[model samples]
Target: MNYFGIIRPAMVTCLMLMLYLAIVVVSLITGPSGLDPQLLSGFSLSPVTGDSEMANVIVTWLLLPRTLMALLCGAALGAAGVLIQGATRNPFASPATLGVNAGAMLAIVLGSVFLPQFTGQFPVVVAFSGAILTTILVFRLAQAISDSPVNLVLIGMAMTLSLGALSAGMLMFYENRLDGLYTWGAGNLSQFDYQPIQRSWPIIGMLTALALLFARRLDMIELGTEQAESLGVNVRRTVGLSLLIAVLLSSTVVSQVGMISFVGLIAPHIARGLGCRKVWLRLLVSTAVGALLLLVADVAARLIPLLISDSHYSFPAGVMTTVVGAPFMLFLLTQRKRVSALATTPGETGIQALFHLSPVTFLSALAFVFLLIFGFSLFGNLDLQWINLRWPRVLSAAFAGAALGVSGLVLQTLTRNPLSSPDVSGLTTTGVLFVVLGLVLFPGLGSLEMTLLSIMGSGFALLLLLGLSRLTGFNPLLFALAGLCLSAMAATLISMVLVLGSNQSSEVLVWLSGSTYAVTSERFYLLFISVLAVLPLLFAMWRRLDILQLGEYLPSLLGVRIQATVAILLVMVALLSAVSVAAVGGISFIGLMAPHICRVTGLSSHRHLIPATAMMGSILLVGSDWLSRTVIAPFEIPSGLLVSGAGGIYFILLLLSGKYIQRR
Candidate 1:
């Protein structure tokens, strides 16, 4: 290797080692007052004697395990990221991307609620099993639709959301266990029980070792399966082995550390960029980097003083990653060379041959709408009888869904990427956080303030996103990727509001699942105002949105003021999205699904698609909400989870089927 490569690897390794030592030191140093035997006395000055009696006792009994858990868990994640990315041959890949973490988390949450017995005996086992099953299902579903690896990941994502909803449904039935579920969901290291370590090591070790051994082959796979096969590599075996490795590696890590984000997503990429291409180097470098990053992140999670001059400032490490990692990922996407993410539909089927109503689409959609209304009737606590106001719930759901549908449609059109929606873009999460923060800081900010602040936050996030793209010279695909990361981060940071909040916050989490729950007349009025506002703007720029989808140069050549048009459209989206988030907490997949359904069904024209999407969105939240509440009679699933369950699966189906292959 060249001097730069050699020096770079060494530098990172040294830094990682230093951080590792630092973690050991910190863990050894800090503890509760009366816990350590030697430190219990409050002072000590003997080498082995006092250290062992006090710090060692604390370390061995307390911090040692935590530190080791951090190291091992982080290492496993780093390796897993490399394995999955190499296998999928996509840069924008993560376990979360395929819904593995979401599904596993959902399962864990449900188990805590419905199957508390399992939580005691086989929590990790159940989580691993759930993750493995979902991964396989997503893989199979994707392969069945389209055998492309990238599409497989997308399908896997769909599976994640689908399973996530089912898991949510289970949680809804067992809301008594909601507190524990949320705590576990954060991937916190506070669960320092030692038995989990024994249960965990065997699986993590085997998979990580296997991955390391086959790291060279993985690098080959990264080179391109066809090319690797040309060089006498068994493409099928390599792919299988790589995927199996990923499953085991990730599952093992989840079983222990819960689900830490971005370690797997970013570690390997950074490792390779730092010149760890060879299996041995990549494995070691990634492990080192992972350990270092997680340790620091853990420390950051603990140490970053919430200096909010505001009333209640709370922070969590998991949230920190999203806040930090989201922007970092975006920056990475910006810095890296941009590639066309415009995957076209395969087989040259235009609106002519493939103009079908999206298989299982209409039924699923209608059923979802009907069930949401039905659900509204069942759920009641004290004076709150959900079933009584079915019409109001439907009305509320309709407006919220319409707003999201319009938001997603505009995002897709302006960005020209089907995946470009508020949820994916972090716009919704940012707006919601703004609302929550406002509530936290200044107690009685009326609904108007909430709406206005939501709009402002969304606008700021959008502006930063657009400006960042320009500064970094990133393409649309990368820009969207960055947005997703930021959104993920925002979601993480904002979750603290739920976790640390009083009963009111708990109510928000339960109700925010994109369902038609408690919508009164006033909220509907605001939503109506949002709808009317967007309509006129959309009407004026009818044709331009269509051409914008063609690409950057084509629209500009067609006399479109791309920048000005995009900015105006973004303002409309923010107004709509702010209204949506304010009305119905942050929902996922509706925007993505509506547009996809329209496109797949040959309703590509902006004129028809926009209105149709509005209808689709309205139908979706209402139907989904109905089913969510009525599914189990007494308890109700949130509309968000229900939609994610079904819609997520359908999304994966599209991804795997190569439905968008060259079709964009």
Candidate 2:
């Protein structure tokens, strides 16, 4: 009767274990065939031969491995989250946020495409190698910029986007050979045998053990580096080793289960909330929590069809995790007391002073555009028929890119954050999500219908982002973080829709990847009209943007209506982004890159910046479209993927340059 205080931790652990066991049972019995009473009786280690043989086989070979894999992967990811957060002294750190998962995914895709023999035999090794390399790259870049948590996460996100785009490009190129990988890429837990589970569990266990061994050191390190070093803990060594173990654990799971988002992130918080204070206890609780979360998600993934009679597709467990986990991430952001904000006048004076306006630069940009146009027009042959086919795509790319450029410029000025862009701010992805949903619901949605859906989605996303970030006064880094969460959710929803709409999946995938393959004169005209319609409104706001750049307080003092101006600018951005995305799918980075390119060229005036950015964006996308068509010839890469890959690299470089680093 007096055991409550004496065995609280044990009691909690036991309760969680019981819950996990119940869920495991549910997972076993719930699936397409529904609950089988025979499974309960016939479930045995050894093969059963009788009326219950089928149940025994299903339980033994199918359900057991899948259920066990989910448990093990969740435990590993949860432990990895604890290790990473402990090492970084930042609660936001996780494998998915730190580029580890993306790197592992890219490695697997590369191995599958280039070295199938080796990759097939040693997928874990490939994933680990990729994870380690990307982790190193992210850490190095983040350290070089600043030691802020926001910087680390932003740099990690940059690398993740770049790696993800590269992986997508490869997947698109080799879709025929890697047909089944699309589902696996979304994080599947289906298993026919125990081989993968057997291979993964031992490695996960060993790495997790190593992580637990560092518990005391991590606890000390969390006290602060100076104190930890004074206490005889090699702070650097502990952090590095902890991160290494985290990567190993995460990569091990990814190698088996593909990319499961947010388990690592969600579990540690749950453990802490459950009153696990000490590092060791927290790690253990986090392990349990992660397992429970993943198991529950997997069970939900399995039970959806049973619960919904018309549902035919079983969504990947990863999508379910994101559906649940993204909100958690946003909640964490809202709880933060302070987030690093970008400097009000980001490179306004310094950039302008360092690089004055040069006609040569402008002329060079123009020449490049003309050159790309020439190449596009005459790349394959000098035939008029080829010219007629290529012109619409080239023009569509130019108009869409211009719209994105102006949109990005407006957003950057509005938020006073150099990193603000339609794609990064969730506008493009949300727009694409709605467009895809429309396609799924209506199947043959016309241009006007798609554009309307895109506009509605983008507007909703903008409002949601603005509302969520308002809690922190719209701090730039937190705003970006919030947008990233929205983007992830939209992407997961898009994936689910694509999975469910199998008939339109391929076509939608191509469009979602930002293809210009289907561009025609009609589509080109729609893009042109949309871009032209928005340009005048944007130009009229240039003066407001310039004044707003001086900072919100100054702008208000100067009689500028900050809220009204921002509201107007955001509506314009949403419109531009919606139209562009409708025309070219969810192309990323043009909005981010074009305006930055303009700033780098010493054009600080909004008047000049807006036009120059539009032109630069047009040049960039037109050039990308040309490369997409010519690089692999008959098989084209998606222009959006190309821009994303290039833009990701640029973003990392921008961080490395320390241009965006604002010292608190």
Candidate 3:
């Protein structure tokens, strides 16, 4: 018997199946109430028939439903992963990456809010529709952009963040109505009945059957559309059907079990790594792998509360997946070969042919900013208290936005990476985490101490990212990916602190969401000074930045002290990012968005680009702050949320326009 040969096909499959079944049994045994033998008996064909009502209740009501749900959701996501990967021929594609999970979650929330009477299948249908729509939107956006597989994921991420913000806003607006939704949105797996399993299983089973039925066609489609068409495949129909089924499966799981993050992504990759090349085998193996992975995560989620002896701390299963999956995603990114030329450069002639800023245009923009900052008010009547209150908030927004804009401009130019920004570069996130950690550890840490701590953290993060880039042979994508991973880790830490800490402070919540509500005149003064100090140094180095943009080798050959230049600029970025984090608490991507917008709006040179981007940033943030205040008056959304949601959409539009895709 050739264990490695095709005839016998190895014993790995049988072993894996046994392992999965074992895990299922283990999951059933472990619960909030611990293992019960009579519970097992209750689940068996014959009822316990003894004084085992408690055991029967636990099995019938709680343990059986959730364990079964974990298996079903995991299997569904796994099958969805195979279909998505096959359809797109992109290894990184998944429900989370394609914005399907976010869209479905949003749909469920809306359905719950609007159609309270519609139950059972209504949310599933709405979620499925949302997922399909998001998929189509992402596909169209990616098509409009460059053909790089990476673009699909980027656009999807932007869409995901935007949709997430919208859903969060909805949840906030109706928090009383949807009281337990916050926990559920984080992906809870608690089941009091067998309804979710009963509802989700049929849809998942049908999707799995469809995947197996269309396996050959999907396999052919992976060989490129032209080749597939040549091989007598209706390429478009096959691709569309595969994606539709994939989204349906994914959205169904989300509707039933909340937002499980990465099972879909990790499963198919594991199957392929294990040499499951044939489509049917891969689909089955992926499904099994996903089911097993999620079952373990769900078990861990259940056990966490027990371990901590705090049942109030209901750690969602999705957070467990994220804790594992985020690092896995980072590992996959680290494995990519060094690939540079990720940043788009404006043509030399375009940069050289600089236009002077028109006085009228400048003042007009300034006037617009003034009107937005001062003219708008939610409270109809203004008084001395209002004047004092409003100005500081407005100034805080402006200064933070300007700092972000300048930080982004410098980081992008220095790294020569369009994707570089305070948030995406991991600066703001690290800074926020460091400050939050300081709050947890020191207990009585002052605002000033927190600011200094965050600044140091931002500096450390920048240095660490630089070190990673150097080790990775300066691959822009690798730098971006590493930064993204760091950011995810920081975000996870923040979430843990928010959920688990004793304080559970509303002030901290406001800060984490990037609110200006907590910004005092004192804080505004600190931020203003920081911005003023940073801008001058940035202006002085603007010409050097322009010279350096002519490729790395040329700058050094042209007598530029490349190392000194990068160090100084990075310090500047760190300082600016730290201040914004201090003031606004992770107002992200303004740096990414503002500089890109400046270039598109004809401010390509560093001289014009730096100041123009700063001005634009101020306008952007202030306007966002105004909108945040006014959008649903009396119940304000965070300025950070508004900025991020709007900026993410704008960045996607930029990608769709083929503006940011660099031709190397």
Q: lDDT per prediction?
A: 0.66, 0.83, 0.78
* Model 2 CA lDDT for position 184: 90
Stronger candidate by lDDT (1 vs 2)? 2
Model 1: residues >4 Å from true position, as ranges?
1-15, 32-58, 109-125, 137-169, 177-179, 191-193, 222-227, 305-317, 338-392, 468-476, 499-504, 549-554, 598-601, 628-636, 653-661
Candidate 3 Cα lDDT to native: 0.78
- Measured against the true structure, the TM-scores of the candidates, in listed sequence, are 0.82, 0.94, 0.89
Model 2 superposed RMSD (Cα): 2.8
**What lDDT is reached at residue 632 by model 3?**
87
**Residues 1-664 of candidate 2: C-alpha lDDT, one tens digit per residue:** 7787769867876897788788888888764566655687556666667857877777878888888989999999999999998998777779988889999999999999889999989999999999999999889887875556875776676577678888888888788988878779778999988899889888988888878799999889878899999999999899999999999998898889899989999999999988887899899889988988998998887776456544657888999998998888888877745343321222331222235667566756666775666475445577888888888788888889889999988877776667778888899999999999899878888888888999999999999998887776677667776887788899998987876677888678889989787876776787888888889888987888889888658999999988888888888889989988888898999988888877876677787887788888888888888888889888788898899889988887776676654543
Reference-based TM-score, model 1? 0.82
**Poorest 10 consecutive residues by lDDT, candidate 1:** 344-353
> Which pairs clash inside model 2?
none
- lDDT, model 1, position 306: 31
lDDT of 1 at 199: 73
What's the lDDT for residue 446 in model 2? 85
TM-score, model 2 to reference? 0.94
- How many residue pairs in model 3 have overlapping backbones? 0
